[model samples]
Target: MEEILGILTQLGLTEYESKAYISLVSLINAKADEISKNSGVPRSKIYPVLENLEKKDLIKIKQGRPLEYHVIAPEISLKNYEENIIHNIHILQQKLTRIYEEKLPHVNTPIITVEGLDKILKKEYEIIKQTKKILYLRIGFILPSEIENIKKALNKLINNGIKIRILAVEECEIDGKVVSIRDIFEDMDVEIKYKQLPSAQLIIRDYKEMFLVFAENSGMSISNSNMVGLFNTYSVIISNYLSAFNKQWSKL
Candidate 1:
Protein backbone atom coordinates (compact mmCIF):
# COMPACT_ATOMS: atom_id res chain seq x y z
CA MET A 1 0.00 0.00 0.00
CA GLU A 2 1.09 3.59 -0.61
CA GLU A 3 0.85 4.44 3.12
CA ILE A 4 3.06 1.50 4.09
CA LEU A 5 5.66 2.54 1.51
CA GLY A 6 5.62 6.09 2.91
CA ILE A 7 6.18 4.85 6.46
CA LEU A 8 9.00 2.58 5.27
CA THR A 9 10.72 5.50 3.53
CA GLN A 10 10.48 7.53 6.73
CA LEU A 11 12.26 4.74 8.55
CA GLY A 12 15.26 5.11 6.16
CA LEU A 13 14.32 2.70 3.37
CA THR A 14 14.60 3.52 -0.34
CA GLU A 15 11.42 3.14 -2.42
CA TYR A 16 12.72 0.13 -4.38
CA GLU A 17 14.00 -1.53 -1.20
CA SER A 18 10.64 -1.03 0.50
CA LYS A 19 8.75 -2.49 -2.44
CA ALA A 20 11.08 -5.49 -2.71
CA TYR A 21 10.92 -6.10 1.04
CA ILE A 22 7.10 -5.94 1.00
CA SER A 23 6.95 -8.42 -1.86
CA LEU A 24 9.36 -10.79 -0.10
CA VAL A 25 7.34 -10.39 3.10
CA SER A 26 4.19 -11.52 1.32
CA LEU A 27 5.97 -14.46 -0.35
CA ILE A 28 7.90 -15.37 2.88
CA ASN A 29 10.79 -16.46 0.60
CA ALA A 30 11.40 -15.55 -3.07
CA LYS A 31 13.96 -15.24 -5.87
CA ALA A 32 14.90 -11.77 -7.23
CA ASP A 33 12.76 -12.35 -10.35
CA GLU A 34 9.71 -13.24 -8.27
CA ILE A 35 10.21 -10.16 -6.04
CA SER A 36 10.51 -7.88 -9.11
CA LYS A 37 7.33 -9.33 -10.65
CA ASN A 38 5.31 -9.07 -7.42
CA SER A 39 6.51 -5.55 -6.48
CA GLY A 40 6.35 -4.05 -10.04
CA VAL A 41 10.05 -3.09 -9.78
CA PRO A 42 12.33 -3.46 -12.81
CA ARG A 43 14.18 -6.80 -12.83
CA SER A 44 17.53 -4.97 -13.16
CA LYS A 45 16.86 -3.04 -9.88
CA ILE A 46 15.42 -5.85 -7.75
CA TYR A 47 18.74 -7.58 -6.90
CA PRO A 48 20.38 -4.35 -5.78
CA VAL A 49 17.26 -3.36 -3.77
CA LEU A 50 17.20 -6.75 -2.03
CA GLU A 51 20.94 -6.44 -1.27
CA ASN A 52 20.35 -3.00 0.24
CA LEU A 53 17.51 -4.38 2.38
CA GLU A 54 19.82 -7.11 3.62
CA LYS A 55 22.48 -4.52 4.55
CA LYS A 56 19.80 -2.56 6.45
CA ASP A 57 18.87 -5.75 8.40
CA LEU A 58 15.34 -5.69 6.95
CA ILE A 59 15.89 -8.88 4.87
CA LYS A 60 18.21 -11.92 4.76
CA ILE A 61 19.34 -14.27 2.03
CA LYS A 62 18.46 -17.97 2.39
CA GLN A 63 21.23 -19.94 0.61
CA GLY A 64 19.71 -22.17 -2.09
CA ARG A 65 20.09 -23.26 -5.76
CA PRO A 66 18.60 -19.84 -6.67
CA LEU A 67 19.28 -17.60 -3.65
CA GLU A 68 16.01 -16.64 -1.89
CA TYR A 69 15.30 -13.33 -0.04
CA HIS A 70 13.42 -13.58 3.29
CA VAL A 71 11.86 -10.59 5.09
CA ILE A 72 12.79 -9.92 8.72
CA ALA A 73 9.72 -9.57 10.95
CA PRO A 74 8.39 -5.98 10.92
CA GLU A 75 8.17 -5.90 14.73
CA ILE A 76 11.82 -6.86 15.23
CA SER A 77 13.21 -4.69 12.41
CA LEU A 78 11.21 -1.60 13.44
CA LYS A 79 12.25 -1.95 17.10
CA ASN A 80 15.92 -1.93 16.10
CA TYR A 81 15.27 1.04 13.77
CA GLU A 82 13.59 2.99 16.59
CA GLU A 83 16.48 2.32 18.99
CA ASN A 84 19.07 3.46 16.41
CA ILE A 85 17.11 6.63 15.75
CA ILE A 86 16.90 7.46 19.45
CA HIS A 87 20.63 6.91 20.00
CA ASN A 88 21.54 9.13 17.04
CA ILE A 89 19.22 11.91 18.24
CA HIS A 90 20.69 11.85 21.75
CA ILE A 91 24.24 12.14 20.41
CA LEU A 92 23.30 15.04 18.14
CA GLN A 93 21.57 16.89 20.98
CA GLN A 94 24.60 16.65 23.26
CA LYS A 95 27.04 17.88 20.60
CA LEU A 96 24.89 20.74 19.36
CA THR A 97 24.03 22.00 22.84
CA ARG A 98 27.72 22.25 23.74
CA ILE A 99 28.40 24.30 20.62
CA TYR A 100 25.45 26.55 21.31
CA GLU A 101 26.63 27.32 24.85
CA GLU A 102 30.25 28.05 23.96
CA LYS A 103 31.22 31.73 24.34
CA LEU A 104 32.58 33.74 21.40
CA PRO A 105 35.96 35.54 21.37
CA HIS A 106 35.77 39.09 22.68
CA VAL A 107 36.33 42.04 20.35
CA ASN A 108 38.60 45.07 20.98
CA THR A 109 35.71 47.07 22.37
CA PRO A 110 32.82 45.32 24.11
CA ILE A 111 30.43 48.28 23.71
CA ILE A 112 29.49 49.54 20.23
CA THR A 113 27.49 52.67 19.50
CA VAL A 114 24.86 52.31 16.79
CA GLU A 115 23.43 55.36 14.98
CA GLY A 116 20.19 55.88 13.09
CA LEU A 117 16.73 54.75 14.21
CA ASP A 118 16.31 52.13 11.51
CA LYS A 119 19.65 50.47 12.28
CA ILE A 120 18.83 50.36 16.01
CA LEU A 121 15.48 48.69 15.31
CA LYS A 122 17.20 46.13 13.09
CA LYS A 123 19.70 45.32 15.84
CA GLU A 124 16.90 44.90 18.37
CA TYR A 125 15.12 42.43 16.11
CA GLU A 126 18.34 40.54 15.45
CA ILE A 127 19.22 40.26 19.15
CA ILE A 128 15.75 39.04 20.03
CA LYS A 129 15.88 36.42 17.29
CA GLN A 130 19.06 34.99 18.82
CA THR A 131 17.51 34.67 22.27
CA LYS A 132 17.25 31.04 23.39
CA LYS A 133 15.68 31.13 26.83
CA ILE A 134 14.51 34.53 28.10
CA LEU A 135 14.14 38.23 27.20
CA TYR A 136 13.64 41.43 29.21
CA LEU A 137 12.43 44.76 27.80
CA ARG A 138 12.03 48.21 29.29
CA ILE A 139 10.22 50.04 26.52
CA GLY A 140 9.87 53.76 25.80
CA PHE A 141 7.44 55.41 23.42
CA ILE A 142 7.76 53.70 20.04
CA LEU A 143 6.41 54.79 16.67
CA PRO A 144 3.18 53.09 15.61
CA SER A 145 4.75 51.95 12.34
CA GLU A 146 7.39 49.87 14.17
CA ILE A 147 5.28 48.51 17.06
CA GLU A 148 3.78 45.78 14.92
CA ASN A 149 7.24 44.60 13.92
CA ILE A 150 8.32 44.35 17.57
CA LYS A 151 5.09 42.60 18.54
CA LYS A 152 5.48 40.03 15.77
CA ALA A 153 9.07 39.27 16.85
CA LEU A 154 8.05 38.80 20.48
CA ASN A 155 5.06 36.65 19.49
CA LYS A 156 7.37 34.26 17.64
CA LEU A 157 9.60 33.91 20.75
CA ILE A 158 6.54 33.36 22.96
CA ASN A 159 5.29 30.61 20.65
CA ASN A 160 8.72 28.98 20.95
CA GLY A 161 8.32 28.93 24.77
CA ILE A 162 10.79 31.75 25.43
CA LYS A 163 10.01 33.64 28.61
CA ILE A 164 9.45 37.38 28.01
CA ARG A 165 8.87 40.16 30.54
CA ILE A 166 8.14 43.76 29.50
CA LEU A 167 7.95 47.15 31.19
CA ALA A 168 6.15 49.68 28.97
CA VAL A 169 5.44 53.38 29.15
CA GLU A 170 1.80 53.96 30.08
CA GLU A 171 0.71 55.38 26.70
CA CYS A 172 1.82 57.14 23.57
CA GLU A 173 0.18 59.16 20.80
CA ILE A 174 0.22 57.61 17.34
CA ASP A 175 -1.10 59.76 14.46
CA GLY A 176 -3.51 61.56 16.86
CA LYS A 177 -4.67 58.23 18.37
CA VAL A 178 -3.59 57.49 21.95
CA VAL A 179 -2.60 53.86 22.41
CA SER A 180 -1.60 51.95 25.51
CA ILE A 181 1.60 49.99 24.90
CA ARG A 182 0.46 47.29 27.32
CA ASP A 183 -2.87 46.89 25.48
CA ILE A 184 -1.08 46.27 22.19
CA PHE A 185 0.74 43.18 23.55
CA GLU A 186 -1.83 42.05 26.12
CA ASP A 187 -3.12 39.31 23.80
CA MET A 188 0.33 37.76 23.67
CA ASP A 189 1.83 35.37 26.28
CA VAL A 190 4.25 37.96 27.68
CA GLU A 191 3.86 39.60 31.10
CA ILE A 192 3.85 43.42 31.02
CA LYS A 193 4.03 46.15 33.64
CA TYR A 194 3.11 49.81 33.01
CA LYS A 195 4.94 52.97 34.09
CA GLN A 196 5.97 56.30 32.59
CA LEU A 197 9.51 55.80 31.30
CA PRO A 198 12.09 58.24 29.90
CA SER A 199 13.02 58.59 26.23
CA ALA A 200 15.32 55.54 26.40
CA GLN A 201 14.58 51.81 25.96
CA LEU A 202 16.55 48.86 27.29
CA ILE A 203 16.45 45.28 26.05
CA ILE A 204 18.36 42.28 27.42
CA ARG A 205 18.52 38.85 25.85
CA ASP A 206 19.19 35.77 27.97
CA TYR A 207 21.51 37.95 30.14
CA LYS A 208 24.13 37.60 27.40
CA GLU A 209 23.57 40.76 25.31
CA MET A 210 22.02 44.20 25.78
CA PHE A 211 20.61 46.99 23.61
CA LEU A 212 19.80 50.53 24.74
CA VAL A 213 18.04 53.23 22.72
CA PHE A 214 18.06 56.93 23.64
CA ALA A 215 16.09 59.76 22.11
CA GLU A 216 17.49 63.30 22.64
CA ASN A 217 14.13 65.01 22.88
CA SER A 218 11.01 64.13 24.90
CA GLY A 219 7.54 63.92 23.30
CA MET A 220 9.17 63.51 19.87
CA SER A 221 8.83 60.45 17.61
CA ILE A 222 11.79 58.05 17.92
CA SER A 223 12.08 57.88 14.12
CA ASN A 224 13.82 61.27 14.17
CA SER A 225 17.49 62.31 13.82
CA ASN A 226 18.06 62.58 17.62
CA MET A 227 17.83 58.83 18.24
CA VAL A 228 20.96 56.86 19.15
CA GLY A 229 21.65 53.32 20.34
CA LEU A 230 24.28 51.45 22.36
CA PHE A 231 24.78 47.70 21.94
CA ASN A 232 27.08 45.29 23.79
CA THR A 233 27.69 41.66 24.63
CA TYR A 234 29.76 42.50 27.73
CA SER A 235 28.59 40.35 30.63
CA VAL A 236 29.15 42.93 33.40
CA ILE A 237 27.22 45.70 31.64
CA ILE A 238 24.41 43.27 30.86
CA SER A 239 24.22 42.25 34.51
CA ASN A 240 24.12 45.85 35.72
CA TYR A 241 21.31 46.82 33.38
CA LEU A 242 19.43 43.64 34.27
CA SER A 243 19.68 44.56 37.96
CA ALA A 244 18.40 48.08 37.33
CA PHE A 245 15.60 46.76 35.16
CA ASN A 246 14.57 44.28 37.84
CA LYS A 247 14.63 46.99 40.50
CA GLN A 248 12.41 49.24 38.39
CA TRP A 249 10.21 46.35 37.37
CA SER A 250 9.49 45.45 40.99
CA LYS A 251 8.33 48.99 41.74
CA LEU A 252 5.71 49.00 38.98
Candidate 2:
Protein backbone atom coordinates (compact mmCIF):
# COMPACT_ATOMS: atom_id res chain seq x y z
CA MET A 1 0.00 0.00 0.00
CA GLU A 2 2.79 2.36 0.94
CA GLU A 3 4.70 1.37 -2.19
CA ILE A 4 1.67 2.06 -4.38
CA LEU A 5 1.15 5.43 -2.72
CA GLY A 6 4.83 6.24 -3.24
CA ILE A 7 4.64 5.30 -6.90
CA LEU A 8 1.51 7.41 -7.35
CA THR A 9 3.23 10.42 -5.80
CA GLN A 10 6.21 9.89 -8.07
CA LEU A 11 3.85 10.07 -11.01
CA GLY A 12 2.84 13.59 -9.87
CA LEU A 13 0.12 13.01 -7.28
CA THR A 14 -0.01 14.70 -3.90
CA GLU A 15 -0.17 12.56 -0.78
CA TYR A 16 -3.79 13.35 -0.08
CA GLU A 17 -4.78 12.78 -3.67
CA SER A 18 -2.91 9.48 -3.86
CA LYS A 19 -4.50 8.20 -0.68
CA ALA A 20 -7.98 9.24 -1.78
CA TYR A 21 -7.49 7.65 -5.18
CA ILE A 22 -6.27 4.40 -3.66
CA SER A 23 -9.18 4.29 -1.26
CA LEU A 24 -11.66 4.99 -4.06
CA VAL A 25 -10.08 2.27 -6.20
CA SER A 26 -10.60 -0.24 -3.42
CA LEU A 27 -14.18 0.92 -2.88
CA ILE A 28 -14.84 1.14 -6.68
CA ASN A 29 -17.56 3.78 -6.26
CA ALA A 30 -17.67 5.67 -2.96
CA LYS A 31 -18.95 8.94 -1.51
CA ALA A 32 -16.52 11.61 -0.30
CA ASP A 33 -17.21 10.78 3.36
CA GLU A 34 -16.44 7.11 2.80
CA ILE A 35 -13.23 7.98 0.95
CA SER A 36 -12.16 10.32 3.77
CA LYS A 37 -12.74 7.57 6.32
CA ASN A 38 -10.96 4.84 4.39
CA SER A 39 -8.11 7.00 3.10
CA GLY A 40 -7.39 8.75 6.41
CA VAL A 41 -7.80 12.06 4.59
CA PRO A 42 -9.62 14.71 6.57
CA ARG A 43 -13.25 15.08 5.48
CA SER A 44 -12.58 18.74 4.67
CA LYS A 45 -9.78 17.78 2.23
CA ILE A 46 -11.32 14.67 0.63
CA TYR A 47 -13.66 16.52 -1.73
CA PRO A 48 -10.91 18.78 -3.02
CA VAL A 49 -8.56 15.81 -3.48
CA LEU A 50 -11.19 13.83 -5.34
CA GLU A 51 -11.96 16.84 -7.53
CA ASN A 52 -8.28 17.09 -8.40
CA LEU A 53 -8.15 13.37 -9.20
CA GLU A 54 -11.17 13.85 -11.44
CA LYS A 55 -9.44 16.74 -13.19
CA LYS A 56 -6.47 14.48 -13.84
CA ASP A 57 -8.77 11.90 -15.47
CA LEU A 58 -7.98 9.34 -12.82
CA ILE A 59 -11.53 9.26 -11.46
CA LYS A 60 -15.11 9.77 -12.65
CA ILE A 61 -17.72 11.75 -10.72
CA LYS A 62 -21.40 10.78 -10.37
CA GLN A 63 -23.63 13.78 -9.65
CA GLY A 64 -26.42 13.54 -7.11
CA ARG A 65 -27.33 14.88 -3.66
CA PRO A 66 -24.09 13.27 -2.50
CA LEU A 67 -21.33 13.11 -5.10
CA GLU A 68 -19.72 9.72 -5.68
CA TYR A 69 -16.38 9.04 -7.40
CA HIS A 70 -15.27 6.00 -9.36
CA VAL A 71 -11.66 5.07 -10.07
CA ILE A 72 -10.52 4.77 -13.67
CA ALA A 73 -9.14 1.31 -14.34
CA PRO A 74 -5.47 1.19 -13.31
CA GLU A 75 -4.25 0.08 -16.71
CA ILE A 76 -6.11 2.86 -18.55
CA SER A 77 -5.21 5.52 -15.97
CA LEU A 78 -1.51 4.66 -16.01
CA LYS A 79 -1.30 4.52 -19.79
CA ASN A 80 -2.93 7.94 -20.14
CA TYR A 81 -0.64 9.37 -17.43
CA GLU A 82 2.45 7.92 -19.11
CA GLU A 83 1.53 9.43 -22.47
CA ASN A 84 0.85 12.82 -20.95
CA ILE A 85 4.16 12.80 -19.08
CA ILE A 86 6.14 11.88 -22.21
CA HIS A 87 4.44 14.57 -24.27
CA ASN A 88 5.24 17.17 -21.61
CA ILE A 89 8.87 16.05 -21.47
CA HIS A 90 9.36 16.48 -25.21
CA ILE A 91 7.70 19.89 -25.18
CA LEU A 92 9.93 21.00 -22.31
CA GLN A 93 13.09 19.68 -23.95
CA GLN A 94 12.36 21.48 -27.19
CA LYS A 95 11.60 24.73 -25.40
CA LEU A 96 14.75 24.62 -23.30
CA THR A 97 16.96 23.62 -26.22
CA ARG A 98 15.73 26.50 -28.29
CA ILE A 99 16.36 28.98 -25.48
CA TYR A 100 19.84 27.60 -24.88
CA GLU A 101 20.80 27.85 -28.55
CA GLU A 102 19.36 31.32 -28.92
CA LYS A 103 21.35 32.63 -25.99
CA LEU A 104 24.67 31.14 -27.03
CA PRO A 105 25.70 33.91 -29.40
CA HIS A 106 24.73 36.64 -26.95
CA VAL A 107 26.98 35.41 -24.15
CA ASN A 108 29.10 38.34 -22.93
CA THR A 109 32.26 36.30 -23.00
CA PRO A 110 32.86 33.35 -25.26
CA ILE A 111 35.26 31.65 -22.86
CA ILE A 112 35.10 31.35 -19.07
CA THR A 113 37.99 29.94 -17.05
CA VAL A 114 37.22 27.37 -14.36
CA GLU A 115 39.52 26.24 -11.59
CA GLY A 116 39.85 23.03 -9.48
CA LEU A 117 39.28 19.39 -10.40
CA ASP A 118 35.87 19.16 -8.69
CA LYS A 119 34.55 22.27 -10.40
CA ILE A 120 35.88 21.06 -13.75
CA LEU A 121 34.14 17.73 -13.33
CA LYS A 122 30.93 19.47 -12.33
CA LYS A 123 31.13 21.64 -15.41
CA GLU A 124 31.79 18.57 -17.55
CA TYR A 125 28.64 16.92 -16.22
CA GLU A 126 26.62 20.08 -16.74
CA ILE A 127 27.80 20.49 -20.33
CA ILE A 128 27.16 16.84 -21.09
CA LYS A 129 23.59 17.14 -19.85
CA GLN A 130 22.99 20.00 -22.30
CA THR A 131 24.11 17.98 -25.30
CA LYS A 132 21.18 17.42 -27.66
CA LYS A 133 22.54 15.02 -30.29
CA ILE A 134 26.20 14.09 -29.92
CA LEU A 135 29.11 14.43 -27.49
CA TYR A 136 32.75 14.18 -28.41
CA LEU A 137 35.35 13.89 -25.65
CA ARG A 138 39.12 13.54 -25.57
CA ILE A 139 40.96 13.29 -22.31
CA GLY A 140 44.60 12.51 -21.57
CA PHE A 141 43.78 11.57 -17.98
CA ILE A 142 40.91 11.44 -15.52
CA LEU A 143 41.05 11.53 -11.75
CA PRO A 144 41.00 7.96 -10.44
CA SER A 145 38.33 8.77 -7.87
CA GLU A 146 35.76 10.31 -10.26
CA ILE A 147 35.79 7.88 -13.16
CA GLU A 148 32.83 5.84 -11.95
CA ASN A 149 30.57 8.88 -11.70
CA ILE A 150 31.64 9.99 -15.20
CA LYS A 151 30.90 6.55 -16.62
CA LYS A 152 27.44 6.54 -15.07
CA ALA A 153 26.57 9.91 -16.62
CA LEU A 154 27.87 8.78 -20.00
CA ASN A 155 25.79 5.61 -19.84
CA LYS A 156 22.67 7.65 -19.14
CA LEU A 157 23.37 9.92 -22.11
CA ILE A 158 23.83 6.90 -24.36
CA ASN A 159 20.54 5.45 -23.19
CA ASN A 160 18.89 8.74 -24.12
CA GLY A 161 20.04 8.25 -27.73
CA ILE A 162 22.94 10.65 -27.57
CA LYS A 163 25.81 9.54 -29.77
CA ILE A 164 29.08 9.67 -27.83
CA ARG A 165 32.61 9.32 -29.11
CA ILE A 166 35.51 9.33 -26.67
CA LEU A 167 39.26 9.55 -27.23
CA ALA A 168 41.38 8.66 -24.22
CA VAL A 169 44.77 7.48 -23.30
CA GLU A 170 45.35 3.73 -23.02
CA GLU A 171 46.81 4.21 -19.52
CA CYS A 172 47.77 7.12 -17.35
CA GLU A 173 49.15 7.74 -13.88
CA ILE A 174 46.64 9.16 -11.44
CA ASP A 175 47.28 9.71 -7.75
CA GLY A 176 50.53 7.76 -8.12
CA LYS A 177 48.79 4.70 -9.59
CA VAL A 178 48.59 3.65 -13.24
CA VAL A 179 44.95 3.70 -14.36
CA SER A 180 43.57 2.10 -17.50
CA ILE A 181 41.12 4.53 -19.07
CA ARG A 182 40.02 2.13 -21.83
CA ASP A 183 38.99 -0.59 -19.42
CA ILE A 184 36.81 1.81 -17.47
CA PHE A 185 34.65 3.25 -20.29
CA GLU A 186 35.04 0.91 -23.27
CA ASP A 187 32.35 -1.49 -22.13
CA MET A 188 29.68 1.21 -22.27
CA ASP A 189 27.58 1.94 -25.39
CA VAL A 190 29.92 4.60 -26.75
CA GLU A 191 32.55 4.71 -29.46
CA ILE A 192 36.02 5.04 -27.91
CA LYS A 193 39.52 5.22 -29.28
CA TYR A 194 42.73 5.01 -27.24
CA LYS A 195 45.84 7.00 -27.95
CA GLN A 196 48.63 8.82 -26.11
CA LEU A 197 47.65 12.48 -25.85
CA PRO A 198 49.03 15.62 -24.26
CA SER A 199 48.06 16.66 -20.73
CA ALA A 200 44.72 18.14 -21.72
CA GLN A 201 41.05 17.29 -22.11
CA LEU A 202 38.44 18.48 -24.60
CA ILE A 203 34.67 18.10 -24.83
CA ILE A 204 32.53 19.21 -27.77
CA ARG A 205 28.77 19.15 -27.45
CA ASP A 206 26.49 18.88 -30.48
CA TYR A 207 29.31 20.50 -32.49
CA LYS A 208 28.30 23.85 -31.04
CA GLU A 209 29.90 24.16 -27.59
CA MET A 210 33.49 23.46 -26.54
CA PHE A 211 35.20 22.82 -23.21
CA LEU A 212 38.95 22.41 -22.81
CA VAL A 213 40.89 21.58 -19.66
CA PHE A 214 44.67 21.85 -19.43
CA ALA A 215 47.04 20.44 -16.85
CA GLU A 216 50.07 22.44 -15.71
CA ASN A 217 52.30 19.39 -15.67
CA SER A 218 52.05 16.21 -17.75
CA GLY A 219 54.12 14.10 -15.34
CA MET A 220 52.21 15.12 -12.19
CA SER A 221 49.23 13.15 -10.91
CA ILE A 222 46.08 14.51 -12.64
CA SER A 223 44.11 14.63 -9.39
CA ASN A 224 46.75 16.74 -7.67
CA SER A 225 47.90 18.76 -10.70
CA ASN A 226 46.85 22.35 -11.27
CA MET A 227 43.86 22.20 -13.61
CA VAL A 228 42.27 25.03 -15.55
CA GLY A 229 39.35 24.82 -17.93
CA LEU A 230 37.89 27.06 -20.63
CA PHE A 231 34.25 26.83 -21.80
CA ASN A 232 32.70 28.54 -24.80
CA THR A 233 29.90 28.24 -27.31
CA TYR A 234 31.53 30.18 -30.13
CA SER A 235 30.83 28.31 -33.36
CA VAL A 236 34.15 29.18 -34.94
CA ILE A 237 36.09 27.94 -31.94
CA ILE A 238 34.08 24.73 -31.84
CA SER A 239 34.64 24.18 -35.52
CA ASN A 240 38.42 24.59 -35.19
CA TYR A 241 38.61 22.27 -32.19
CA LEU A 242 36.41 19.69 -33.92
CA SER A 243 38.65 19.67 -36.94
CA ALA A 244 41.63 18.89 -34.74
CA PHE A 245 39.67 16.25 -32.83
CA ASN A 246 38.64 14.48 -36.03
CA LYS A 247 42.25 14.54 -37.21
CA GLN A 248 43.35 12.78 -34.04
CA TRP A 249 40.43 10.38 -34.19
CA SER A 250 41.41 9.26 -37.66
CA LYS A 251 44.91 8.45 -36.47
CA LEU A 252 43.67 6.17 -33.69
- The TM-score values for the models, in the order shown, are 0.57, 0.61
Clashing pairs for predicted structure model 1, backbone only = none
Q: Residues 1-252, candidate 1, lDDT per residue (tens digit)?
A: 899999998878888888888888899888889899999999988878888888878889988888888888979987887898899999998888567556532432368899987898899898888788999998877766678888899889989999999988877754446667867887888988888788678989888778898876535444345678898877778788888888988887
Candidate 1 vs. truth: CA RMSD?
A: 8.2
User: What are the per-residue Cα lDDT tens digits for candidate 2 across 22-65?
Assistant: 99889999999999999999998888899999999999999998
Clashing residue pairs found in predicted model 2:
none
Give the winner by lDDT.
2
| Superposed model 2: Cα runs more than 4 Å off | 1-94, 103-108, 218-220
Lowest summed lDDT window (length 10), candidate 2: 216-225
Each model's total of backbone clashes: 0, 0
